[model samples]
Target: MPVELDPVKSAQKRSDYNGIYRLEDLTRLSEAVLSDSGQVDVMLKCTYDEQKLPVMLINAVTDVDVTCERCGQPMPLHIELAATFTPKTMRLEEDLVPSNYAIVEVNDYGLVDLRALIEDELMLEIPLVPKHEVENCAIKEQDMVWGELDKAAYEKPSNPFDVLKSLKNPK
Candidate 1:
């Protein structure tokens, strides 16, 4: 289900939110071959820094179906990720922010979409390139070949500077 919260109020109270969102609900995510049964589980906590800047801590796991780059077969990937988000504020110096935390520019309405934030985080955690384990891949070594020169055929070409050397020597 979608979740929305007031950033200021939630942070002040240090609210704890735990819920599961349907994977189908995230439209902005890259398209993957989804398993019939998959879910996004999340635990979101809101707190304020010493300076009263709102911060969000997220813990989440999601299941997604992805094609194996090697075998071209669909496989399930369990993605686990954690993230920290602080609403950007004029009062908060960027240097004060921890390297691990990401800054978000909250909308003018001061409302945050909890589901969307977590969804975006999970998306980022997904691998840029997905591949099945070598042993698990259906493709065999014989099926694919990387260029390999026969030892006898391996011969080095003359150096590019050879022409200049010969020109100087005139031999």
Candidate 2:
């Protein structure tokens, strides 16, 4: 099961949680992956920083297969995430959040869904165009087809003015 806890409360107690999220649990990420069976190892620690701000440290890792854009075949992709985030209770706090730590929004109940957060972070780590290395991809750059001109389409069309010229020249 995925981990979900109150960031502020957990931080006050300096709590730590470790869990695994099945790929299927992440609906958005599952759609982008080639295989349906996999799991992400997640570790979350909530504590008060020296500035008296509640922060959470997150670490997540996963291995999955994504379609190679070049060859249209499945390729292995490893995703790793490490981030520090301070809970933002109000829009005004956005400016107060330190630049070194990311800001995660807290709900009216002061709870932040760690499962969704990890899924979102994983999605961001995925490459826009997943592909195997040049030496490994079945399709190479030289094999790519940009386009080809049709021989019939490129043939010069008969000029309408040619008839008039032929009549004037008696040819």
Candidate 3:
């Protein structure tokens, strides 16, 4: 079943569910952000504990395409992650501790926004550098050639100053 982040009902009774949440249902996230190649799928399974606080367990998998820094080749990367979230009543600070989980406040009806929570989890899972392993990798031939050329260029010194000094010193 689809879980909507109802701020009212969430505060009433602790709810737990196990299902696949659709990306379209998460209205809080911008469409452009979701369309990005890095995000593939996001799933959440969670429940509210006896204390009337929301507890979310999230599983997210994303596919990213990045260029190799060394070879300038497109690299396919996959990231899989899982985490837990706990809702709290305290006002979150602007610079609080960074965590994969999110805390949602229960409204008068004790409702929590499950969709928003899932979006947050997905955002946190993105990697800083998306790269694949070397050797038998899916790198473009042109990029590999460029990499070799670059390495050769660097290795072959064209230092005019050094050449002049050597000539003058006659060593």
List per-prediction Cα lDDT, in the order shown.
0.77, 0.86, 0.53
Worst 10 residues of 2 by lDDT: 89-98
Where model 2 places Cα greater than 4 Å from the true spot, the runs are 1-3, 90-92, 145-171
Candidate 3 lDDT by residue in tens digits, 1-171: 444555324334444454554545544333424234333365555565454445666676655455556555666555576776665545434244246555566455545655565666555665555445656456644455543454566686677798789888985
Poorest 10 consecutive residues of model 1 by lDDT?
A: 28-37
Superposed Cα deviation of residue 1, candidate 1 (Å): 5.7
**Where in model 1 is the C-alpha error above 4 Å?**
33-37, 50-52, 147-171
User: How many angstroms is residue 83 displaced in model 3 relative to the true structure, after the best TM-score fit?
Assistant: 1.5
lDDT value for model 2? 0.86
- The sequence of per-residue lDDT tens digits that candidate 2 reaches over residues 54-103 is 88999999999999998898999999999998887753357666788988
Candidate 3: clashing pairs of residues = 5-113, 7-111, 10-110, 10-111, 11-110, 11-111
Q: TM-score for every candidate vs. truth?
A: 0.77, 0.80, 0.47
Q: After the best TM-score superposition of candidate 2, give how far the Cα of residue 83 lies from its true spot, in angstroms.
A: 0.8
